[model samples]
Target: MPKRYIVEVDGVPPSPSPISNAVVVGNQCWISGQLSVGDDGAYVPGSAREEASRAFAHVFRIAEAAGFSRSDIVYVDLAFIDLADVKEVNGLFGELFPEGRRPARTVYQAAKLPFGGRIKVQAVAPR
Candidate 1:
């Protein structure tokens, strides 16, 4: 059996949800869903693309804390509050993955997200 460890970030209190901030099992790191909520618990708002950037930034921070770099990322899952933002979201993704070696990605629209956030992102990477 592989051991799964939690990677907790500094300053942010424990999550109110069931997931750890991030988890590392063996050679794999799995980051929990991340939103644009600031440390102060405020949601940052902008065009969907901007919000998507913010969300990915948050997930990237978690990946860093888990000792994984963006290059190690192998998969990504994104959920949007509205389907209308697909193109904008993909644009931001392109900016992040300009070399076209983006991790396997899945994007879908959800009715809502915590803190009324417009988008949430989760990532899987090598530990």
Candidate 2:
């Protein structure tokens, strides 16, 4: 079995709990859900679209920390506070994974998110 490694980014504030942003084993990385929280540990206020964008950015950051890129992502999971915002989320997805190279995705609505965030995103990438 390949050894597993925890991945963390410099300058990103640690979570209050003992959860790694991502764990890598062999060539595959499992990323934790990324939210719209700023570096100061506060939830960023914005529309669902903006918050989703930031959350995806964090996912990309974690992927990069694990020696991968957004293009390496094979799967993505997104949670939104409002299902009505699916269109906005899809737009951001199109922007991130353009030209029919999008990854497998599962999107749904959540009753509530940590820190009252509007969106949360997690991804799996294979190096």
Candidate 3:
């Protein structure tokens, strides 16, 4: 059995809730839901693409903090206020993850998100 450790990235705002940003056991890391919020915990206002990019940035940063490579990310769980933004968010995802090296993703139309964000993302990595 491997020891589990919580991961925290510097410059990322700490969550006001009790949730751990991420947890790692052995080679795998499960990053909690991340939003497009700045270090001040304020939502970064922008289009869905921009917001998704920031969300993805937060996920990758947390993954990196756990010693996982960006390309090594194995899964992602995305939540969106609108399903219409999937294509746009996918465009940004493709740009970041690339085609040949993409993670398995599940997208959902969320009723509402924390911080009133239009988008949120959670990730699992190191497959």
lDDT of 2 by residue, 1-127 (tens): 9989999887555677689999999999999998887887678989888898878888888889889998999899988888988997888889999976799999888999988888889999997
lDDT for each of the candidates?
0.82, 0.87, 0.88
Q: Which 10 consecutive positions of candidate 2 have the poorest summed lDDT? A: 9-18
Return the lDDT, model 2, position 84: 89
Q: How displaced is residue 41 in candidate 2, in Å?
A: 1.7
At residue 38, what lDDT does model 2 achieve? 82
Q: In model 3, what lDDT does residue 9 have?
A: 88
Say which prediction, candidate 1 or candidate 3, comes out ahead on lDDT. Answer: 3
Off by over 4 Å in 3: none
Say which prediction, candidate 1 or candidate 2, comes out ahead on lDDT: 2
TM-score, predicted candidate 1 vs. hidden true structure = 0.89
| Model 2 misplaced stretches (Cα beyond 4 Å) | none
Q: TM-score for model 3? A: 0.95
Q: lDDT (0-100) at residue 47 of candidate 3?
A: 98
Residue 115 lDDT in model 3? 84
